[model samples]
Structure formats: structure tokens, C-alpha cells
Target: MLPKHDVCGEPLYTPKIIFKEQGETKYETTDPYVWCRKCKKYVEVEVTQK
Candidate 1:
């Protein structure tokens, strides 16, 4: 199920995976998430590995 906005109680949209480079190592890291149109932000929905 999709996550709901805390303030607006609206459903969030699942987009592309978000990734971040850690240190000098080229490892990409991120968590599973959803995008809130109402809040205009990405909200984490599940834990993920680096």
C-alpha cells in the first residue's frame, strides 16, 4: 500500500528509485519510498540496503 500524507491524508505516488553515493566508494544507497504530491516530497515506506 502507498503511504499517506501526515498533514493532508492524501495518497503518495511511487516513482523512480532514489540513490545517493556513499563516500568515495561508488556504492549507491537509499530506501524504498513514495512521493507525496500534496507535500511535494519523498517519504520512506520501507528499509533498504546500501
Candidate 2:
């Protein structure tokens, strides 16, 4: 079961993942999970180095 909403106090479903990376730096964020509308889940990833 999903965790209760942080505010509403109900099961909340999130379906999205975002990734930001550059050269050697990488950042990833996700909202639980969900089925991809086309093939598999979709996420935006960016890579950059400092």
C-alpha cells in the first residue's frame, strides 16, 4: 500500500521520475512510480560536469 498523503492523509500515487546529470554530477527524483504511456516509464535526464 502507498504511504498516506503528507497532507490529506490518504494513499497518494505518483508516477514520474526526473533525472539531472552533468558530466560527473547526477541528480534523480521520483514520485513513487507509474506505467509508461507508450512503452515504459519515462524520465528526463540531463548530464553536466563541474
Q: Give the candidate number with the greatest lDDT.
A: 1
Residue 7 of model 2, lDDT score:
36
* Candidate 2, 1-50: lDDT as tens digits: 54343334444345455888888988886644433334334333222222
For model 2, what is the error of residue 35's alpha carbon versus the real structure, in angstroms, after optimal superposition? 16
Q: Residue 26 CA error for candidate 2 (Å)?
A: 2.7
Candidate 2 residue 46 Cα shift, in angstroms, is: 25
Model 1 spans > 4 angstroms off: 15-31, 47-50
Poorest 10 consecutive residues by lDDT, candidate 1:
24-33
lDDT of 1 by residue, 15-45 (tens): 4555566776564444467777787877766
Instruction: Score every model by TM-score.
Output: 0.41, 0.32
What residue runs in model 2 are displaced by over 4 Å at the alpha carbon? 6-8, 30-50
